[model samples]
Target: MMNCIEAHGLTKQFAGRLALNNVDLTVGSGRIVGIMGPNGAGKTTLLKAILGLTPFGGELKVLGRDPWVSRDALMNDVSFVADVAVLPRWMRVSQAIDYMNGVHPKFERAMAEGFLSKTTIGREQKVSQLSKGMVAQLHLALAMAIDAKLLVLDEPTLGLDIAYRTQFFESLLHDYYDKARTVIVSTHDIDELQHVLTDAVFMDGGRVVFSCDMTDFDAHFHEVAVKPSDHELARTLNPLHERHSFDRSVFLYRNADVEKLATLGEIRTPRLSEVYLATISNQTLAQKGSPK
Candidate 1:
């Protein structure tokens, strides 16, 4: 597959401290990859670097052209919906649609308006008057209408409620994702987006600590529960992470025979949130995933 976005030896500095250190990433065409990390983990920094919103040290290519030097040309084929609900406040929804049409050659005005109808937004309403979730929906609808080869979304569902967030991603997959296009999403809602994510990247303190295909997410992590009596036995297996409920405790472990787990109670697939806790633990980082 062709690379839609590539970063090599990327580094960024803030007050003499490194935000990103020799970071490298490859996003192939037509893949929905998620960049996951805690707050202040350089997730937005990487997006900004890719969007040419900030100057950073390294090589970046979007659609085979340098993003920093080729921002104008690159933006013609790349679109972004940042985490911030920063729609044009004074513009009416219709006016914003019109502006998008004028700026993006392939903007689909009709589709955008149609998509907006799925929400409660009135076409005549000013952006400033819309609620936060409404703003997210508006941006989502507009981004979906772009015919860009690459779409970069930062915290794409930030203010959305459950229904809108669910509908937004479904619409994104149906309308925007295709073999010739790419979608890169940054979000904290791992559980919601896990289903559609093709790959996952975990960053910390401006550096990538974990990168893996999401298909392997289910393969490598397992969620299990054990009876109080079997707690010591479960711990002996070196569970990746563990938590306690009332009478039973939950754990995330790697390939600890299910037969052995039968004594522990119910075993199930660890959710994205559970996997996150297991993999992103302080001990895991300090011991296994260290460049710190």
Candidate 2:
């Protein structure tokens, strides 16, 4: 598979305090990879490092080119939208589109028009007057227009109501991520994107603690509902995560011991989000790392 992004020992620091430790990452072309972590887990730092937005330590590459040195070349093939609003609030919707076209080589005017038309954002409205959600959608409009090979969205759906979030992601998959572009989204809501994801990477304390592919999800991890009596045996193996309600328990575990677990009651396949949370929280407990 062609790799659209690569990183080796990528590290970031502010005032000598480590924000991102030495980390390695690889993102393949034509895949949508979801990145999740609690606040300050280094999700945004990693994305900015990949985009060459913040100066940092270690090697980072996007589109097979070093982002630190070849940012202009990298930007030609990649696009990004940080959580904060970027466009000048004073600019009108039409002005933002015109400026993007002037700045990016791959900007498509017609693409931006069609995207904005699907929503209520008028070409005439000043960005300053637009609601938070409208600004996000406007940002999405420009991103989809860029014709980039890879897109990185940092909590793009944040501040939007449920309906807009649904419409936005639906438009992203159907219109932008069809067959050509790769996307990596950093979000807190893992379950929201679980269905459409091709792969997942979970970050804890700036390190990737879990990574899995969608096609292998159910086959690799499972949840079991068992009697409270089995909790002791289950604890020995260090289950991913477990919960108790009343006298019963639900345990999430890797699929490695599926056969042995047959004796446990009512085994069921887990959703990606469930498995992800279980793994990270359990790993944290074992490491004595407090969740942020």
Candidate 3:
């Protein structure tokens, strides 16, 4: 598969503070990649770099073109829905469609209208009058209507209800996704998107701590739940992270002997959220060193 995005030694700064620190990432085409991170973790910065909205040091390319130099050209084959607020409040639904049709060469008028027809949003209704969820629906309609090879979404469902959030992703999966296209979603809702994501990228403190295919997760990580009596035996194996749960202890192991761990307790595949927490916590612990 061809790479949709490539970055090497990518670094970004804000007012002399590093926002992206020597990041190297490659996103292959036709995959649903979830960029998971907390606030100020360079998630938005990386997206901005890919979209050519910010200046950075290092080689960065999206769709094989330098984003900073060919942003306008790159946008022809790329589409993004950053936030619900991206649409103007005074614009009516019809006007938004007209504007997109007029400006974007790849806009598909019938497809966009087809998506809107299923929603409560009406052509005459102004953006300000619609509910948050309705606005998000409109944004998704517009974004999905574009025949772009790459789609970038930055918290596209923020401030929406659970139903809307669920609808947003379902729509993307069923209506928009195809093997010829790639989608990158930056979100804090890891568990909700875990099933849809083919790959996961975890970033913390302005750096990417882990990036791997979801299929490889089991090979590199494992979670074991043991009785309190087995805690000492489990500790001897040097688990990456451990915490108490109910009356038992849960340990997260990285590249450890899974067969050996099985004897200690019940072993199961860790959720994406658990793996993210373990990875970030371990990085912090290593940086802090053993408590003296």
Candidate 4:
């Protein structure tokens, strides 16, 4: 598969403090990748770098062009949606469509109108009159109508209610996704977002701590529900993480003997949320033990 985005030794610093540190990442075509991390972990910085919104050091390319040097041309093949949609307050729904049609050569006005037809938003409704959810709908309709090769979303559903959030994702998967388009989404909603991801990357301290394709994740990680008598035995295998639930305990392991784990207790594939927590926990431990 051809790579849509590639970076090696990518470094970015803000006021002498590192935001992205020697990062190496590659995103191939037709992928739905999720970027997760705690605050200040460089998730946003990485996304910005991909979108050519921030200056950084080292080799970085999006669609085979240096992002920093060719950002204006890059914008033609890229579309972005931030947590907050900032449309012109005085522009009506119809005008927004017209504005996008005039600026983006790839935007399909009929397609945008078709998407809006499913929503309650009226053509005469001004941006200021629409609710937050409506604004998100408008933003999504506009963005999805474009024939961009890469779509970047940063906290696309930050403040919406559960209904809106669920609807937003459903619309994205059912309407916008295809084998020709690549998507990169940055959000903290791991549990809700995991299902849509073809790959996931967990970052900490401005670096990638863990990354895996969803299909291969199971082979590399496992979890076992251990009986009280087997807890000690399970610990002997050096489980990556362990958690208790009143009378039962689950131990997360990486590259352990499946047969041995099965003998210890019930073995199953771990959830993305579980693996992500374990990755972050282990990263913290490693940092604490590193030399000053």
Which has the better lDDT: candidate 2, or candidate 3? 3
Name the candidate, 3 or 4, with the larger lDDT value: 3
User: Model 3's lDDT to the true fold?
Assistant: 0.91
lDDT of 4: 0.90
Give all candidates' CA lDDT scores: 0.83, 0.83, 0.91, 0.90
Q: By how many angstroms RMSD does model 2 differ from the true structure?
A: 2.4
lDDT of 3 by residue, 1-292 (tens): 6699999999999988889999999989998899988789999999999999999999998999999898999999999998788889999999999999999999999999999999989999999999999999999999999999999999898888899999999999999999999999999888899889989999987899998798677787788988999999999998878988899989988888988999998888778899888888887877789675
lDDT of 1 at 143: 82
TM-score of each: 0.87, 0.93, 0.95, 0.95
Q: Tell me which residue pairs clash in candidate 3.
A: none
Question: What digit string (tens of lDDT, one per residue) describes model 4 on residues 80-147?
Answer: 88875667789999998988899999999999999999999999999899988888888889989999
Candidate 4's error at 1, in angstroms?
4.5
Among all candidates shown, the one with the greatest lDDT: 3
User: Candidate 1 — which residues are off by over 4 angstroms?
Assistant: 228-236, 255-266, 283-292
Candidate 4: clashing pairs of residues? none
CA RMSD, predictions in order: 2.9, 2.4, 1.8, 1.5
Off by over 4 Å in 4: none
Which ten-residue region of model 1 has the weakest summed lDDT?
283-292
Candidate 2 lDDT (Cα, 0 to 1): 0.83
